[model samples]
Target chain A: MNEKPLELIHGEIDGRISATEREELRALLDADPKLREIRSELQKLAESFEKVQPLDPPAGLRARILTAIRPPEKPAGLAGWFPAWPMPTALRYGGAVAFGAAAAVVALQLGGVGQGTPGMDVTGLAGTMARYQEPGPAGDISAIQLNLNELHGTITSHLGEGLVILDIDLTTTRPVAIVADYDSGRLRFSGYAQTDDSAMSVTNNDHQIIVNHEGPQHYAVFFEGDAKDSVEINFRFVADGQQLHEETLKIPLVN
Target chain B: MDTDNELELVRRCQKGDGHAFEVLVGRYEKPIFNVAFRMLGNYDDAADVAQVAFMKAFENLARYNPAYKFYSWIYRIAINEAIDQLNRRKRNTELDEARLPDWHTPEQAVRDTQLSAVMQEALMDVKTDYRTVIVLKHFMDCSYEEISGILDIPVKTVKSRLFTARQLLKDRLADTGLL
Candidate 1:
């Protein structure tokens, strides 16, 4: 077969040949048995291409993404009585101003400084204690604050021992615990709150606390002994919960 | 329900409405992910690339000219992202070595597992550039023009690539005496 005829046959199999070209190739195939065989081979190859199906993605990818884009806790159930309005308008602008003012007031009280010093520095030591005590109108302690000093660290109460921390350092929201186990050393660290109640413990030579969840969450290092003097736990908040946040502290062993 | 509704959703999404975008994403997510998987040959990479493409499309919805079809715009983004992922994998030696088995039979009574195995091996033997075009054309059933648009290649280039892809497949199969 000539180069042009072979190319035409390929084009026909690929659905790329013009109508006239297809006609020509069809005629040639009808006239020659050998060319017909060549056409069959090309057809098989094309059909084989169709056999490969697209596989499903590994599970958990979608949930991780949706969680990432979720907004701050405005309200839930009957508490969300405010009007839902479209963005880029007067209502959005007004909402933004209102939110800014409320944030400023909270910042000032926590920062331990006057309103003149760039609002409230509601972070570090001052904000940690305030956030722990005040559970907000939502009746949920959205997050916990940890005071990691050079030698010692303080974990604010309200984050119970059984609760697991899935993430830390989230903006304006606390981390949710999907699982918890204290015996296995799976403890919710400072700077986050637990949401889920799932927990497990494994008693091997070295007891391991395994907190299983469908998604990523915060965790802290712990030792297997009641003697706290030999164990030092370091914790940090993560941005996406997958990446560790820059701010971190080591909880010194209480000897 | 139709293209008009889809376009309306897109318009709503462009105005910073997340719900509308989520709806649009829900509608096209499966097909887009399938296309990405076929192009990239890896499930994890395809999912990541598809998600990124949707997010990018959402972020730049205003820049999307209304004259073009929505699928065309979104698909263009997906194809480019898939190709970029393929290239990045090649550079990083992160190409998923996991091979997907095929399911084809000659008797047409039951799918031939053996044939599927042979076909998968044959496909892996072909170069990535050729395999991508073949998958888009045959598996996805994209028209030549659509393929050309997605890949950002001329119509003639699409033809040439498809032709070469077929030739490579035939040669591989013939070597295995599967022809």
Candidate 2:
């Protein structure tokens, strides 16, 4: 009897052997009663384990697990949307004023009250304003840098009133588009506004807002609106419509 | 449960159906709890690990790949949590033996429980990796392929580990005259 094929018996008993191996094992066992005896012993060992009972989980375990997975309790009122970080003194007061002013401006523009605000068309303007207009009751800015190759910048954003405004300070030698990837239906590209720069234009699809800049420039861009708790922005430095440098910033939903 | 059924439940969960996820929790809670119980040798710690594993699974469901069985993916989480619990317990001087609750009552049940306890004692002597494969195969009834996917090990490695583990268990049980 070949002893090497003995391993096949173990695998066969465990249901881990292949079909061809099963045929081989059957032939080996039929020609050898000793191999049959070994198989029976292995089967008894496996059966002995079957006598071991599985313990029942605690009655409350299912409930406890479900409770833990239940979406975290949404923060109450405006407090739910913002991080619980202490706000800077200037931002505390200035943010509230800016938010009020921005909201009023957006409400007016949407109501067709301001036809030529130059930089208030992006739907995110109202959100941007709300984000920084008033000091958030809580939470810190979840920010990421736009550092990819020749580009360098910083983006700081906070959540409030169901929106976030990306306060982006970017300096790049190549023309770059600062894109905000908002969750579908959760966030809207309300509006866009940029500080004095070489040249800038904003366009958007359903999922993202693309800001195109021309030549070397330093600018602070504000993109906002919609009710998403988080946003992911990608900085794509482009030359002749081809992407040269790309970096991504992921902002988690605070709520 | 069929992977297709689980895939449907997972799709519902991905679409934000908390109730569907709760059904999944009910389905998996026992096996996951058992895995932790056998690994940690205590009820409270196992329960804690099981709860954490389910929560982690739900929170990270978006990252779950659909190509693998959901049980394999979730079992991996439970095993990791169990191993981590064991490591944490090792750091402390005293084991919380009190945390193991008693369930035996009838005479036959009592004998079985005692036998199980001896078996578990022998299991504790096995290394964690070996112990894991053994438990997955014998106690959890996981196929070798399932074990491979759950532990992220090659099939040959799984076979080798099981062989070593079975030998060790057989030796330990026989030494105690319980085999």
Candidate 3:
């Protein structure tokens, strides 16, 4: 069979043919009775497909699906979801962003990513922008999940562009201050910022940072994770000047 | 939902919002299940594959690219799952070719059963690659471009696959005295 007419036949049946192509198809059918037969057969084929009945999935399938995801499946070593980690190829070329002074820090606060969906107490995600646009190294990903009553989210460490980016996505019931203390010997503090427009104030004094904010917020803190062994950072969660909890994180600087 | 809302739901899901994931599942489960039914031809297998597809989608939400439609991404997952199931069936049965599908349903009108059975057989006769295009185009009501996106193939490849699939279906139907 002539490929062009066959192509046009499918296009016309699919309702994808332009006026010019439809006219071309008509001429082809006129030139050969076999092409007309093929076109007729295809039209009927489509009509038959229209009669394919849709069946309902078995009962309880939705429940089963949601149950499978209640814990949110993760890879073998990680316990939570991390956002916008780069592909290995892209990560290989990632230029780590490093700062001159300070080291790694972990600041605990009450906040969710961008939304405070009830029943789940984890800061969702700060919306990792697409990977190609963000520079990140091809290295290990470490994440910690928090299910605190006041704050729910994940703090994730990603190696990229020669810097360790700690992503904090969370929601807070009240105003919370995140106090972070880092050793200057193992790492360098690059920067920190909230990912979206929410009221926030941050204070840093070389060895410590105190961030005060309220509601759902997402942010990133970058540090030079170039230490030979690992980096540890201490965090103090404070609400209205009272400490709520404390956490310390040790990240192997293995990039 | 609009594209903006859909993207927002996806974003929320990535952020660990179970509600957002449920909303997405509610919106797409029916069509995805139907696509699975058409591809696999067994209601039970279709249900299993559809459920697994959504599970995989949830597990990999973080790696999803926002540049494409969320439905496209999920559809691609569901279709790929269906194909994988088909391959496993082949390996277990050691069949040289796919058997005629049993598409019977208790709710189906008796009048339509013969035609539906014939349609199922014709569908199973086509190769998986072509069967996928047919399911996306005819069952899922997708455009050629949408089909291309779901299959991760060029539009040209989609057209060729659709054409071949239709030709195969038409020839089979003719053999069965349906056309």
Which lDDT tens digits does candidate 2 get at residues B1-179? 78899999999998888778988998998899889878876554666678778767876789999999898999999999888767755764232332233422233243448777887888888999999998899988998889999999998899888877776776787788776
lDDT of 3 by residue, A1-255 (tens): 658888888888888889999989888889999888888888888987787676666444564355335433343232222222322322211111111011111112223222343311223211222122222323336666677877777666765445566777778788777777888655655454345545443444445655555778776675665477777778777776577778887677663
Name the lDDT value of residue A100 in candidate 3.
7
Say which prediction, candidate 1 or candidate 3, comes out ahead on DockQ: 3
**CA error at residue A226 for candidate 2, angstroms:** 48
Q: Give the 10-residue window scoring lowest on summed lDDT in candidate 1 chain B.
A: B100-109
Best by DockQ: 3
DockQ of 1: 0.16
User: To one decimal, what is the Cα RMSD in angstroms of model 1 from the true structure?
Assistant: 15.3
Ranking by lDDT: 3, 2, 1
Docking class of 3: incorrect
Better of 2 and 3 by TM-score: 3
lDDT of each candidate versus the true structure: 0.48, 0.62, 0.65
Sort order, TM-score high to low: 1, 3, 2
Q: Provide the TM-score of chain A alone for each candidate, in the order shown.
A: 0.32, 0.39, 0.45
